[model samples]
Target: MKGRSRSTGLLLVISGASFWGVGGTVAQKLFQEFGISVDWLVTARLLTAGVLLLAVQFLLKDRSQVIGVWKNKRAAIMLLIFGLAGMLAVQYTYMASIHHGNAAVATLLQYLAPAMIIIYLVLRKQSVFSRQDFVTVSLALAGCFFLLTNGSVSQLSVPAPAIVWGVLSGVALAFYTLYAIPLLKEYDSLVVVGWAMVIGGSALSFIHPPWQMDFGSLSAEAYLYLVFVIIFGTMLAFWFYIESLQTLSPTETSLLSSLEPLAAVFTTVIWLNEPFGIYQWAGTACIFGMILLLALNKKKPAKSNDSVENEEPLRVS
Candidate 1:
């Protein structure tokens, strides 16, 4: 039974991560082939997924948590900050990255969040700069260099705006991961994330109202893709990942989650026919190695807040 449970957990995590990766590719298709705006897609995805998640919480968990989170003044403030600055920022930046570049590059760039988190912790004196940390950071930087420049310092493989958005996506992702730890520890992950999504989506709605899109122009197939992004990519992906934690260790789950980038790379290359050079593949390998090192490290970083090892953030594409 134990073996069966572990296998199930592995499958759930892999499926969840793959959904997120492929979702990004579908999003790319929407942006390039169907002319969907990033703001519109982000707003629609957050609002729809957020509501659905809350509905699940209302049905299965404590219904009060759906609203109880806002009763506390401090939690409310933090939620607002997380929603606007962290969730909204991450979503917008990621979609913008996909809009400016392909999904493969965008997803790979966002995976740099782990390295950024290490740097942030070290600079704050929360963690020591061990040899492992050194290698991790070095590998991330080298990987990023190769990915962007394709082994040359002067030339870039992708556009300038894409690089900027991709890097910003990583920064936003780091903030999203770190900032959500407190909220996650306090309330259920679903409650915190769901509310954050709604808040973020609500704010973005003012900027780019979901109703503002041209509904008539969309084909049934395009609508199906959009539904896939919101349902499979955002909602189910998060749910599956969190569920897998019930049977697997956080380390195992985190390591398995590496399949996200692999899925993105494969789908982007095979389905979209995005050109990837030899240097780019090497860069991808370096990033994967860095992720593996971080996941395998047993020592938890000493910090004022809860350790990151206890909870992995929802990696919504």
Candidate 2:
């Protein structure tokens, strides 16, 4: 049963990431046809996800766990921060990166989250890096900087604000990944997602009022895609992401999910007819090699060090 459950969990995680990987394609399509603002889309996604998640929790008799987090001030505060910093801030900045730069650039830059995770752990003194860790981090960093560079050093001209937003998104994603582990132990995945969505949605709704939405302007296709983003992209993906957190450590999950950018790049090339460049593929290969290195060299703590606790929260979206 344990093995089956784990296999099931791993499957869920991969499927969820895959769903999210396709979301950008769907989103790009919607942007072309419906003229929807990314801010509004983000707001709508958070609200719709929160409602559906809460509905599922109640229907599944998961309210006790939901109420438990509500009663704990520390957990409640953490959820709020997770909603703000992880969900709202990260998505907002990422969308801004896409808005200011090309989605390809934005997508490639965000996967730097894994390297940021390693840096954060090192800063916390929780990381004991082997040569493998150094190699992975070095390769990931080189790939990121190479993608950020435009033509030549003298010709580097990407918008400073876009670069700032992309880097901030990566940092937020890294922190979110690290924090997700311990939170997984404290609450059911859905419960945590529900609360985070509620807070995140509520926060966004305040920034972009619902009254501003033009309901009558939407077409059937737009609504369909919108529903897809909310249901599959937000709700379903978040559940599996959180479930993956249950079994995979932060570094493992972050490294694996780095494939999200690779998926995005390929999907863009095929769906959007975006021209692929050799430099981009080379950078992607380097990132992939880094991820493989991390996966293969994952170290187990010493046999005598069984008491080392995993106190970090599990972050999935």
lDDT of 2 by residue, 197-310 (tens): 778778888778755888898989888888877788678876677667667665556555655566667776787786656666666677777766755566543332321234
Instruction: Point out where model 2 deviates above 4 Å.
Output: 1-11, 156-161, 241-259, 300-317
User: lDDT for each of the candidates?
Assistant: 0.90, 0.69
Total clashes, candidate 1?
Answer: 0
Model 1 spans > 4 angstroms off: 1-3, 304-306
TM-score of each: 0.97, 0.83
User: Residue 201: error of model 2 in Å?
Assistant: 1.4
Clashes of 2: 9
Highest TM-score against the true fold, candidate: 1
Residue 142, model 2, lDDT: 72
What is candidate 2's CA lDDT for residue 145? 57
Count clashes in each candidate, considering only residues at least 3 apart in sequence or on different chains: 0, 9
Report RMSD for candidate 2.
3.8
